[model samples]
Target: MSSQPETYEFQAESRQLLNLVVHSIYSNKDIFLRELISNASDALDKLRLESLLDSALDADTSDLHIALETDSEQRTLTVRDNGIGMSRDEVVQLIGTIAKSGTAEFARKLKEAREAQDAAASAELIGNFGVGFYSSFMVADKVSLVTRRAGEAEGTRWESSGEGTYTLAAVADAPQGTEVTLHLKPEDTEDHLYDYTAEHKLRAVVRQHSDFIPWPVRMETEKPKEGGEGGEGDEAGGTERVVETINSMKALWSRSADEITEDEYKEFYKHVSHDWTDPLETIHTRAEGTFEYQALLFIPSRAPLDLFQQGARRGVNLYVKRVFIMDDCESLLPDYLRFVKGVVDAQDLSLNVSRETLQQDRQIQLMHRRLVKKVLSSVKSMRTKDADKYRTFWGEFGRAVKEGLLSDYENREAILEVSSFPSTHDAEEQTGLRDYVSRMKEGQDAIYYLTGESRTRLENSPHMEAFREKGLEVLLLTDPVDEVWVEQVREFDGKPLQSIAKGQVDLDGEKDDEDDSAKDAKNAERAQREKDFGPLLGWLGTALAEDVKEVRLSSRLTTSPACIVGDADDVTPTLEKMYRAMGQELPRIKRILEINPDHPLVTALRASYEKDSGDAALTETAELLHGMALLAEGGELKDPARFTRVLAGRLAAGL
Candidate 1:
């Protein structure tokens, strides 16, 4: 091993990042200690797991804890943990390289935040892109890390001054686990920077941030004298140094709701989630009988950046008998609930259980089922009890929750109960399914809805014409999942979910109060119109054979000349495109073209077709009508060029 430390320069962006961290990245300097302690706690957790996995591993397991040491004379504060430490390569890769990642983007965000004078925005960027270990620079002018991997004899020392360069070298007699020593900056109370070396300050920081950490956080303090006796030390009043655990180390989940404070819950949430903001809601539940487990889950106020990323970190941290078995145990919660962050400690599962075993374990499945139900129940309760919070929750995670309707059949109804969607009834507010059902028009047999790209498009759709005229509400489903879930979910509270764009919808069929003579006249008028339009319907059906399955007079269209409607069993156009986009090769689904007999365009086309059955222009007119109907319902035309050519020609001839 070399006696002299080797110097290496940081990546260009990393130097910039370090400058930002030391100067402007953090608004609260106290959190620097919280970050260091969090890193220490993680190391401790890893060491505990490592010792369990490898019994022959040469490491101390009896008293694994984190310690904080400070020296006023040396102007240094040290955070040390007797946990799974990093080797030289790990030190270079994790601390050296991680800071460099996304440096450009981080710099840009910091610049923008500074220009906007938004400290909160600058803080948010740090959470989005972690500045965990590097955050130490916020309170310290220089930082050094000395670590020896638990089973390895050799150790490494890394020191940096938050400048462009850092030095690394092999060290002898390094303690097991890692210790980060921060050379404290001069006290600047004007900038809210305090002396981190003070005992009361350290105690306050730990209690506020890491009080619920599973491992003990200890600090050395002056032991009080007995009967006014004096010790032979250089301290004030000749007091002796005694190590005391500063943090509670209390398992927050094990404590009952009444015993724990809201601030305590929020602190635990920040610890588990690494979120800067308070959680929207906290869910606490305990199972005492057959497979017992305690769950403390939190619904975040905002979604994480990785919420939708594939293979992103998900699921709750899993612990067995107060010992962490694994993190991001995907078996505990379904994919849709991936945003939930918390810990689930099982009382019966073995600590040595492998992750694969947990997947197939009956107890795990039971826990998953119970936890899912509890989360859904919590959301449902929030919807009724706290409307504003529920709206916020839905805004952040409603898209994810809608996914449950596609995969979770058992909880489909519960998901719907909590779900709300914008509807034609309201332009700005959304309506839940129960409320939608309650507001159903008298004698309306089915819950009507329209799935499309957006509310504006759905509202302007020709399919909505009749519903709009009759003052009937239609749910506007704009999510990609909406195209699917509406199909899987057949009904809500006994009303079948019927799409206005599919099959046929009769607004007047349930009018029981209509007199017999009026009913007879209306039915006779409908029959006569159908007979009058039969020739044109048949001719258009054959003319647009490749485009439409059938053509008929529409009862759904009131103001529009024509509109397209899928058969009851046919796939929706939006869903078909989604499937095709996913590399699914499906047979082309043909939709029905429904024309309004009262419209002048249809009446003129029928009269001209009767005048000259083989008119060439009439054939193009039929194609144009079919294309118009397809476009009216947001369907793509089979042949856009041909439709355009025919439309252009007709416009020229008319002029």
Candidate 2:
């Protein structure tokens, strides 16, 4: 050990980055505790690495774990670990510089890391980086680290307030690992430092973030020791006080699903999700064979606060052989299922490479395929016993799940079993594609769906009239996102996506040959009527030329005068407005105005053309008919102001 003292100053950029890391990188003040403990773990890991090179350094090590000590009077907290210790020179290089990337480097090289993009690599990033060490600055007026390398000549003391610069001093006789001292801020000082009462908060954080760490994360406990020597000096001598394990430290995924009860699952979810509510449901499965894996997955009852946000929280955790490897494993589940929580513990995967290396590896591809299947199967299973619960889940997360079919081709069918739509059968029940297929009539092959902004609107829609009249079930898809999901899916459960609102639908028979005898009769009658008063149709088209897209006879509309349908490759104006609502720029599509020949209003309008049908009131009534049709199909009426003006003028004239 060096009797002579040494001093080192931090590099300028390192100081700035350190300041940013400590003050701004983390949002929670308690994060400083995790950072300091992690620093201690890093020292221990460093010593362990050195032991591989030098056996003498391993002579005094007992266990690899993090421990905490707090002094109330001094308002200081210390986190110590015995994994790997570093020398004086290394301490000065690391603590004084953000380059002391031992924590960062270890993250890239965690022995517990699974293939990247696998669950474990996510945990690897949390394990890596200097940001954690700097996080100590959040709750401390000053932070001090004393470390002796496992194979080095001496220990070094590094001190900082996280302001700008740090000073390093050579120190004597520290054990093989590292110790971090945080001068607690005033708010958490007295109560937090008293006899390590941080058990409550520490237990919460460990459960939330670090439950699956490879080593047992030990915390200070005060259980009554058995048969203490009745000392008057101690308050708990007669009661017996001792320290015991606070965390179960058990790998939950490795256990059987039945063995884990509801409370345990909920608690574990809280630990994994950092959430306050119990999980809605959990799926625990042990997969064994070519490659063994265990998955403990959860679905929250309520939508996560961050679910719809861009770059939202990816709540699932990852492990390898019961060792915590990553948190927020977005790649483990598709982006659509980001609300899912829990861990995937895999066997037969190597834990020797960096996080990036593992993500692109072949093992990840295999695991990913399997993981998606398992989750989709679990969601499908939810549909059997507790349909109402599944319906509630669908209402919150159904859109996201629909994306699974479009995005993950391998699991498309399984995801289809989970896609739910509002059907004519029940508003409360979300009809699955499988159910829709099961209920389809013989010789009726198409799966019908209608898109709208609301179920009430869709129920009243002229678009649904033909399907309803033919005794066909139509899926009521009201979500704005549902349109894209349906378009992307294109087909499901062996049936193609058929929009009921599309032009000239023939639900009764084949498209072109739909009731040939009836078609001939209707055409013959229309020709006779046309000869009787032919000028009206031409003149009505001229009267509302600006609004109508060829005032043609309608085959689709049964009860309504007319309804708007899109031209080929054109969007409905309602859908166009929705796009604009989401900040999309789009051009207007002129609607195909279809006329119901059976309606008395149409017959009257035709006959009136023989007289002075150019009357302003009659012209306004014709324009009103066009506006009503557009509104009927969820189309926005053009010239709403003009329509208002015409309505007001006609009402005044009638009054």
Candidate 3:
């Protein structure tokens, strides 16, 4: 192994993030101590768990704890933990590269939060990204770490000044765990970054943030001797260094809810989640029967910056009888509920159970089912009991929760009960499905909806014209996932989910309310129009056969002269495009083209064809009409140059 210290440049994104953190991100710099202590507690937890798994491990298991030491003279603070530390390679891989996967995205979100002047969101981003380690830069000018992994003889030391570079070197004789020493900056009372070296300040921070930590956080304080008397002039008779535990070490989840204050819960959430904002909601559930587990989960106030990023770390920590088993135990909850943060402690789980086994274990599955139901129920309660918080929750996590409709079959209906979408019924507020069903038209048998890139797009779509004319409500779904889940979820509350753009929609119910004579006249009018355009429709369909499956009269179009429609079972054009964008291979799918018989464009085209069916200009008009319909529905033309050329020729001839 190389004994010389090696200097490395920070990744570009990491360098940018470091500059932001050191200067702008944190308003309450006192939390820097909180972050370091949380990390120490985690290290102690890991050591305890590793000892349980590896009986022959060489490290000491007797005194596993975290220690905080301060040097007032040097303006420094050190957090020490006798736990599973890191090897030289692990240190290089973990700390040297700050968020390896989404550093750029993390930096972008941080920059946005700063620009928006949202300190809470900025704090949440740092916590959720597992870059809490870098927060030391907020209070310290220089930071150093020395660690020796359990059962390893050699250790590693990492040092950095948050100046776009860090150094790493091997140590022949390092302590059995990890120690992080922060060289604190000069005190700035105005900035609220007070003296971290003061025992009072360190103790207060630890009590607030890590009081419920599972491990004992120790600190040394000098006390006057019991028998010694204080000197009136300058010095005390005697003093002793007493090793004192700073935190309460009270397991918040194990205690009753009434015992813990709201502030305590909030602080604990920040500790576990690394989020600085108060949680949107807290869930506490204890299962007493065959598979016993105590769960304390929190729904975050803001979504993590990487919530949608692929391979983002998710799920909650797992503890077996209050012993840490793993961080992010995905087997405990479904992926759609990944934003939830907390701990689940099981009484009967084997401390040695592998992650693979946990996935297949019957007990874990029961816990998984129970935890998911509890989370959904809490959200449902939020939707009913508190309107403001529920809106905040949805704004942050609605897209993630909607994913459950695809994978969670058992909880599908439960998920739907809490889901909300924008609708034509109300422009300002979103409506739930049940409310939509209740406010539905008297004879409306199917729940109507239109999916597109945006609500503005969906509202203006030609497919929505007849529905709007008939005073029927149509749900507007704009999410990309909306394109998929609608296909999987056929109906909600017994009414089938019908897409207005997919199949032919009949809004003739208004005609049913008319008298018999009026109904007969409307029916006759429709039949006469169809008969007169029957030949023209056939010719246009044959002419545009390569582009459209059929061209016919449209009941869905009232103002628009022509529009595109898909078969009830055919894949949507938007969905087809999505698949193609994902590199999926798909066969060409043709859709129907519907023309409004009342529109002058169609009427004149019919008259011109009747006059001279063999006219070359008639074919150009047919192609132009088809192209216009495609553009109206936001579909791309197959041959843009040809369509533009034909359109220009027609315009020039008219001029």
Candidate 4:
């Protein structure tokens, strides 16, 4: 027997990393047991890989398992595995520091060989990410690693307190593989992660996070209650001990979606989405042409309160042959569809596919296209005379549909079909763009739309004035998503959807700009009144500077004195704000300010402007009028202070 020596202090950097890992990296300390066990499994994988050249290396090993032994009094958890071990020099180099390539790098390099043959791929084994080993510090106060490499000279013991410094020493011959011992902290004793004596807690942690790790994880089983007699002369008496596995992870996506029940799908969603809400709809499909793969996608019923929270889950889970290979495989779908949750599982794909291709998988692209169409169809199916259901679905996932429309050109038509519209439509009912197009009046050549920042604002828009007069029902498109989707889906069912604010709108074949001089003397009188304010319009342009591209008479304005137009191509205020939110700062554009001469405010403005030809008061009043228009059109006020001051001055100075 050898005498024990003084335990060494952790290195400064190692101590910092350990403290961070134990205190910050893992929210649960029980993960230390999982992490340490995972490392033991990793060591086993290393020998399995090494057996490529020498099959006899681990020939004597049986079960190839990792076992856990816990002692409550000592507050220690021991994890042992019968796999590849380590020598004194190897342990010095490997566990002597943190983050050294153990088996992960070697695993990646074997992919090319695996492609040549399935047997070859299986023959070459690997345990990637040496960082998983450090995860032990998340739960344990200290850990001791003892390993003996296959066919190595002597076993090595590496000790770490997670304060950082580690000590390595040679020991007598040990079995092939590794053993990890964890000294759990007092805080951990009460927590699920470290409460090994609490069978339920241990079972929960194993099931929650490590259930799918490809090996048999076992725990001591408790006997059932002595319901029937099992005495001295009975069939059985003493309690029996058994090791039972907690995780039985079967590849879900590899199986047919029809074969998987809704409960299974929901469970997978909970695991993948990290979300608690049930899904509204599911779009599962098989893509057969060119490249082939199965997809199981979900639409969450309720938007997560933290859906837009920074670093929230995005992109479909990606799997190869039913193995969860990566989580953020953006290639399965476009960014606009990021709200969708589920799996894009590739069958023939190499397990070692690059993240870039996982980002741009050709097969996945086809699968994604098919899925987008399916989800859109599902949304379209939700449209019913039942207003409540439609509203519920819309309230939860309507924005996501608009996102798909704007960003996915291939599926724009389908996106158009499912998207909802607020129309001069029935005040109580919402209609789909497809339904709105279906209800278009005879000779209606386009799907006319009017947008504002809010449903209330768009309903009262002056932009809809002339359309209302013609009995033409204009779609009040008010979602922020509507702004972008309308741009992408410029047409629906071959009838182009045109914004009332853009291009020329004709109500009964009359551009609002055209004069109805042929009407009557009353119309003639209205025309004359507009001309009487011509100088006021001119003064407004100067006072607002280029804020009003062309201040003109009103044919479109019915009740309001003035209204801002989506008058210029690059000058649309809605577009400007949208672009600014995307991080582009644009200068305000001049709007075409159309004033209603019938309005009392405009009549008074004309008199004030004519009386004080160069009065600063007149200029300020013009500012107030323009501010009112911006407010009506859902345009943001560039100078809020000036708007308030001008209105206040006008109220103070009376008609």
Give the candidate number with the greatest TM-score: 1
* Model 2 lDDT tens row, 1-655: 5355444556665665554444342334554555555455445544544454466654455677777666768978887776666666666565656744343343334323432324333222332333456656667778888877665556777787777766677777777678888887776443232223356766776565455444556656655545445644536444533444444556667767766666777766755664545677787876778878888888887676447767666746666675445567666778878878888877876654335765686766677777778777777878888888787788778877776665777777777777778899776666788888898877777788888888999999987777777778899988776766666677776688877766556554534554778878866876786565456667667777876656666667789987777654556555677799989998655556677777887777766666776676678778888888877766666789998888788778879
Q: Write the per-residue lDDT of candidate 4 for residues 1-655, one digit (tens) a residue.
A: 1224335665554454444334442234554455565566456555554554366664445566667667778877777887777777777666765544323333333344344444322221211223446666656678888777778756777887776567666667666678888787665334435455456766776666555445567767665435525555434554555677766645566668677777767656654564544566777777676677788788776675435556654788666666446666677666666777887767777665666665465665666677767766766776644466568877776776677675677777776666676678798677777778777777778888876677687778887777777777788877776766666665777888777876444354433344566445556666787677777777777777757668777666667878877542544567677798889998766667777787898888777767778777777767778888888776778889878877887788776
Deviation from truth (RMSD, Å), model 3: 3.0
Each model's lDDT comes to 0.88, 0.67, 0.88, 0.65
Better of 1 and 3 by lDDT: 3
Tell me the lDDT of model 2 at 427.
65
Which candidate order results from sorting by lDDT in descending order? 3, 1, 2, 4
lDDT of 1: 0.88
Candidate 2 achieves a global lDDT of: 0.67
Please give the lDDT score at residue 72 for candidate 3: 94
Worst 10 residues of 1 by lDDT: 226-235
On the 0 to 100 scale, the lDDT of residue 219 in model 4 is 67
Candidates sorted by TM-score, descending order? 1, 3, 2, 4
Over 413-484, each residue of candidate 3 has an lDDT whose tens digit, in order, gives 999999999999999888899999999877788899998888888888889888888898999998889999
Local distance difference test, candidate 4: 0.65
Every model's TM-score:
0.95, 0.66, 0.93, 0.63
Alpha-carbon lDDT of model 3? 0.88
